[model samples]
Target: MTHSPQLWQPLQYGTAEWQRVYFRLRNAIEGMNGFGKDPLYECLESGGTHRIRGIAAQAVLVAFQLAHANKRKLATWAGSIAVDGNRPHRRATRRRKTKPLGSWNHEGYLTEPSE
Candidate 1:
């Protein structure tokens, strides 16, 4: 079957699906230690607590709604941002050079070291 290559599809939820998914997500967050009891209570009453909780809860809600509307055939996708080895490396230690040190003359010109 062919599917639309769009991400703006509408999401919906019905029955106890929202409650189930919400609790599952809540449990996962609680397990992570990032969501304390206070935040959980706050989320139960206001959809979210802290900034992270709010953002995660919003994403979970959207996913739950999509899953519910699409049922078993629904396709849900998630991805994480990653750095692909593009960062520059910083030296952890300074290396000592065995070569004789060069000298800078009074005029600021570098000169070969005298034997």
Candidate 2:
């Protein structure tokens, strides 16, 4: 790792905490992206949905769509929390356990057996 150029935007690169933080953020981003692309929801992939001529218009429409998505997401979150305030906490899933490798020791090999 080069020390001269500090890792900005994300300070931690390969550390354990960095991974945990980034993975959580990635999950949220992917969830929102999926929500935006879904046909029943935002239909962001379809140009006909916006039907706008200029970049400014399209940007405004997209901004509104994102706001709508955020509203829907917030409502769903609030409803879930209201319904089951005492919801059971999920346990951390166990990592796949691999068989421990057997220790091997090298010994001198005789080319020919002693008479």
Candidate 3:
């Protein structure tokens, strides 16, 4: 039998640490793509005929979307600041519901609900 020396590399693709780093980076890129498509934020339209043509125009559009996303994020963070400036407001996972002013009764009269 013949023996051969193996070369050592710093970053092994199959390693746990490398996988974690790779996944994190991949997730970040995916998140950015989703953010760009968000209606409330960048609202980037990918379908149909594009208003701006050419590589330069597309690059400029992407740049503007990124800038808008950054601005909106900053504004949200700024608004979250507490009155005493001690801590930021916690993000609400669910939306708050508002009560309707009036409802129709048996007589078809619009009146407030009886408690």
User: Judged by TM-score, which candidate is best?
Assistant: 2
lDDT of 3: 0.75
Model 1 agreement with the true structure over 1-115: per-residue lDDT tens digits: 6657663333335437667787888897665333222342223234333234467777776555444434422221211222474544333668876543446667867787579
lDDT of 1 at 85: 48
- CA-lDDT, candidates in order: 0.48, 0.77, 0.75
Candidate 2 residue 31 Cα shift, in angstroms, is 0.5
RMSD of each: 19.8, 15.9, 6.9
Residue-level lDDT of model 3, residues 65-111, one tens digit each, is: 78888787777878788778577777768968855546766787777
* TM, every model: 0.19, 0.60, 0.57
> Which ranking of candidates, highest TM-score first?
2, 3, 1
The candidate maximizing lDDT is 2
Record all residue pairs in model 1 with backbone atoms less than 3 Å apart, i.e. clashing: none
- Choose 1 or 2, whichever is better by lDDT: 2
If candidate 2 were superposed on the true structure by all CA atoms, what would the RMSD be?
A: 15.9
Model 3 TM-score, 2 decimals: 0.57
